[model samples]
Target: VFVCKKFLKKDGRKVRKAAKNEIMILKLVSHPNILQLIDTFETRKEYFIVQELATGGDVFDWILDQGNYTERDASNVIRQVLEAVAYLHSLNIVHRNLKLENLMYYTENNHNKVVLRDFYLSRFENGPITEPCGTPEYLAPEVVARHRYGRPVDCWAVGVIMYILLSGNPPFYDETEEENTDLHNRIIFCRIVAGDFEFDSPYWDDISPAAKELVCRLMEVDQMLRITAQDALYHEWIAGNGASEKNLKDGVCAQFEKNFAKAKWRVCIHSCSVNVRLNEVGNNSSRGILEEKPDEDQGLNVLLARNTTQQRYGPLKLFPSSVPAHCHSACPRRDPSTLPHFLSLDYTQMFKVACSTPFLLLICTSL
Candidate 1:
């Protein structure tokens, strides 16, 4: 897609390095589960990054519509994600941001297969990354603390995704901004640092012990102690040798419906701040965040804009909108932590998510 270079020009050095790093890394890797960067274009005003399109909606939306899934289904999905991560770590490439939104189906007809996309925050692990990038909910403890980190952070995010896939809820969350802000901080200090979480009853009662154990090991607070993606692939749950557990499809589906109701409301404040400006920005430019003109593909209305943002901003805002560096544009950078954490989703609020059309537009311009 066409990308504006306004923001990249502002933070020339680091943003360029990050973008180049992502491009180089993506170019080297070829996996069914990882996105392929087909081509690129550079012009005076914009740069175009051409990636394979994912026609089926995101995993979360797919699951919600499917109503429910089985452990086999979760295992199949996680296995693909883990295999992709294992390949990246073997090359010392770390995908710091692995979330539900980043995983998508390759085609509308194939919901069973998923490919991980959006490599904007990825880096090679020659040295530890200390930039504090990635979404808060999936961030590793060391990352949240601003400590040097490596490939294990990706493993931690996998654990979070696995937890949600199994039980249909996040391991750690709060209902309000005050509570979430407080919880977010505590996660950095105590909960995450200490590797603390529980498999509370009912929701997880039917889940296999093997599944829970795998998550516990992967989400270990001590990076040194955490399970690597390669090792996790051999785990009984993922390996498919674990004893059969009760059917969780009905329960999991019920929970997803419940969470989907709250999911839109619980979008990280940081993402919204970066996303909400897309509508205004799109209107201002003929080919802005969302392309008003119809594309050749009739199935997908808007181009899939992809990004994962930290809940708070500092030096990191330099790469706002998470588009490739060449596609950067002007936007007001602000700390959204001061605003209300939760926005209750309703019909009126439909405009909020819809207006932010390029699901990947990470810019939060002050409009």
Candidate 2:
């Protein structure tokens, strides 16, 4: 449990509002790598957020205890952190205050899992965010410039975290406080370019090139060019062949299916071969309206169509060439009652609909 405003602020109203936002965001997000928010409460003087206690403590403390972590250990931790970030971005949330001090570890049934804690600086995508926050060491250039930013700022912090995990020190540092402040200013101005920073330590010698590439991409100054969370998931280091190929294939297939299921449809047509039924028109009239029953063989196809397009057409196919060309031409002009009973029309006039529309083309493209 962490309480706000014991030493930081004196106002209880502000603390309560902040705590409420934190709870709302936490309650909406659920990921294996993110720390679970248990509950929240308010007191006369302070507000408190109850979270799952991390037995392994903060990553900073854990690293300090080990003196330094091996590349394998660092990679495992970083991968989990990226997974958490991916989940956050999926919900359009950005963990703007990410740092080693905020990462926690837990042991359940003798198995360990990293958990991301702290959300004081988190923000919804494009949300009104001001007040330059987060530690200086992990702050992005844009952030230091006090410019408005989105989730990519979190990727910059992830880069800093990666550097710290791999080298046991930040990529940029100075011998004195004054020099450090100067370097920080240079970083904010984009003068201290990331590409110019080289890793010369013995620890980096054994590190894979893919890991280095990913870190560099994540730390890019241009947020537009920075690797997105989804793209990072497909990076060479993260999607390495260590995992079973079958599992990866199945996972990709499942994701495709999930995306396909959400598409909308504009049209559906069905045809049937059953004997046509007719209804009498009037007391003196013998003409009848024709209707055909749906066929069972088309079950799987119908289900697939439904899954692919929100609009469903049953049993019908476009007029076959077997029908005379004249009949095909005249069919469009015929009345519904006189037209072929086997044919059912359920299709959009346009071949392709706009992406914003609820149509089959968008769904097919998504799949």
Best candidate according to TM-score: 1
> After superposing candidate 1, which stretches have Cα over 4 Å from the reference?
1-12, 175-190, 243-245, 260-367
Per-model TM-score, in order, reads 0.69, 0.57
Off by over 4 Å in 2: 1-14, 60-69, 108-111, 127-130, 177-196, 241-367
Task: Report the C-alpha lDDT of model 2 over 34-98, residue by residue, as the tens digit.
Answer: 87765554445434444554445555445444433455666678788889998999899987778
Which candidate should be chosen as best, given lDDT against the real structure? 1
lDDT of 1 by residue, 99-159 (tens): 8767877777888789898776787888867556665567787765546789999999999
How many clashes in each candidate? 9, 11
Candidate 1: residue 317 Cα off by (Å)? 5.5
